[model samples]
Target chain A: MVSVQELLKEYIDEGRIKLDPSVNHHTITVHDPCNYVRKSQMAFGDHMGDLNRWITMQCVDPSLYREMCDDPMNNFCCGAGGGAWAMPYDEERLAYGKIKADQIKATGAEIVMAPCHNCRDQIMKGLPKVHDMGNYKETLYLWELVANTLVIEPWSEEEIEKAHAARDAQFERDGIEMEEEEE
Target chain B: MAEEAKPMEIHIDRKNRKIGGIAPELADRCFTCGTCSGGCPATGLVPMEGAEGVTWDARKAIRAIVFGMEQEVVDSKWPWVCTLCGRCEYACPMGIKLMRSFRAARTLRERDKVPGPIHKGTMMNLERGNNLGIPKEDFLYLLADLGKELEEECCPGFYVPVDKEGANLIVTINSKEPFGEPDDMKFWWKIFYAAKEDWTVSSVNWEGVNWGLFSGDDPAWKEQVRRIIENARRLKVKTILYPE
Candidate 1:
């Protein structure tokens, strides 16, 4: 029942994934997904709002990270939560998103890390067009941000062979054909 | 033909009123201090019908529900606009669970009246295993292609394992990724390859999102949950990572 954010943080802490913050230069801010953070807090008595912050902060330069005026649990929705993004209430959704657009503008960050898909779409595609954003550049998934900054060390030939063998064995066990590669 | 409209009457004696299992009488705990409304971005945005320069807010919705105005509240666009973000509950001095009440309001709407694409998407997700109704062969083909591309990019031996029994993790995906943003799928696979974790993606009923929560269809959402659990059991996976 753990989120991928938890798993990513665990892997990083365990040294399975190494992050290089120097690879990224743009100022970034993390948008707290309401369902992922606030609602979960109300229901489960615990949330990963802080963990998401910790993960995002690890992926960028210390100076490049920015915080919105509102803290994680108290942050504004991207206006797309509760299926508004998929719904036809474009007027209301965009009107609600004006607050988020302002928050991003105030941060002056080039990138807004939206961990949830709905937040990402609204922040990236829906907000800036109407809000007249100046500093806003792009939106990225929390994991995508980490993946881009990953410092991948090349594996040895033996390690490569072992991984190949393991993958092949997995496919075989699942009764899947390795030869069915799509063109 | 010009009969005057009657003013909406409030039922003062209707005590112990509940909406979607959440008691609307809890509105009595509210101070009407406007903290919830002020903190909510949805406030003042729901334009008041037949009136100028006025709108509804969370506190207003609570009051409406208390007055046994469930049908009016259900028909209004107020609940859908709220987004159920929990900011009001988070900041309420009265410690009111505003989002829960709002979610309750959402459930009051008729299925046909549930706002755009959500009801249809829920039905599609139930019938075809995804919101977009992408067929199994197409989904599998797209995954295989993406897997090969990711393998060629950085992870040489990388492959998206489907329905691998006894894996430690079973992952669900948002239909949007495979439908439009297929490249985004690689971010997690890259992580999986790096960690060398034992995880498998289910070939069928792999959608991660349950829009029933949005449309207020509790039964539909529950059925969606059941499908995921059934998939996990079929694969014998101990963990379900629904990263929506």
Candidate 2:
């Protein structure tokens, strides 16, 4: 029942997680997953659902965030929902995703932040490469961006040594050897 | 302006009135509102072959299902075109499950005619304990190997804990990661590292996608669920992160 987006919201709200949007530095649009946003429990009695109010916005700079024309509950599907992503219909799913592709293109965003596995795959497969705009956008998981921009305590040599020791123990414990470092 | 309009025939096959005879609540609910069509992303995209150029519409498809035109529904390519996103179902004032109905309609087709990749993935899930059919040894190797690579790259202490008993989190991964882009696995590892969460991925039945559900293959879907459940039980993890 606990979604990562809601968790991210909680972390940011409590001031435990600080995000620097400039680290990502892209005009980004959120691709709400059907399962998490639309199929999940609804907002305070609003039947149509409020997807545009995605709490994930808390992790990004609102000014840089772009909204898809038909967003949230009313948003067009990426054509990968309902297990269709695994369904064997390639041309059909690709055709079905055209609507989503159009929406992404209209936003002019360089990145599409899709948290769901199916959504990420569908958009990646559906983004047409023939267009000048196609193949330029990067599909990223919500957490990837968060991790990419996370302000971490710089790795001191002491920490690095400890990490290397742990890695060595793991390699030894798991019966794995490090790949040889090439010259 | 009206020269006695001919009365339209209202046909309903009582014997075949229900959908798969499992539940028929929405069988007679569609009043041909066309709202579901408006919300569908695939509505006007793909058309059935040899038909007058018209887009796929859920209301019309549902009407066909309700009236016992099962063969026509199955024959149409529009069934395949449906993303099953449930947008139509969500938009339906009648609250009909449009996607389930489409899946039921899809089942009416011959097993051989079902979409190929999903059909294969479904078979693979039953045979190999996951959709991608990743071998157990290789899966374990990749987990250890990738953990080393990830740690060297960005995550300093990163190690993909495999089959670690009594871990707090039992996270299942998308098969796409191990079978294709291995680098993506590091994203979750980084998050886990930042949070300092104790997690492990099972060496057995590690794939998170159940394509059997996509093809309406019960035994295959059940098999997938059983393996994940057994792995988690065997590992004695506190919680599972199977997103699907």
Candidate 2 lDDT tens digits, B167-234: 87787788888899887888777766666566787877787887766666667778887888788899
B28: Cα error in model 2, Å: 1.4
TM-score of each: 0.92, 0.84
Q: How does residue A107 of candidate 1 score in lDDT?
A: 90
How many backbone clashes are present in model 2?
0
Task: Report, for all candidates in order, the number of backbone clashes.
Answer: 0, 0
Model 1, TM vs. native:
0.92
Q: Which candidate achieves the best lDDT against the true structure?
A: 1
Task: List where candidate 2 sits over 4 angstroms from the true fold.
Answer: A6-18, A41-58, A69-71, A83-90, A130-136, A154-183, B1-11, B15-22
Q: In model 2, which residue pairs have backbone atoms overlapping below 3 Å?
A: none
User: What digit string (tens of lDDT, one per residue) describes model 2 on residues A129-179?
Assistant: 422334236887777777786665435667667756765675577676656
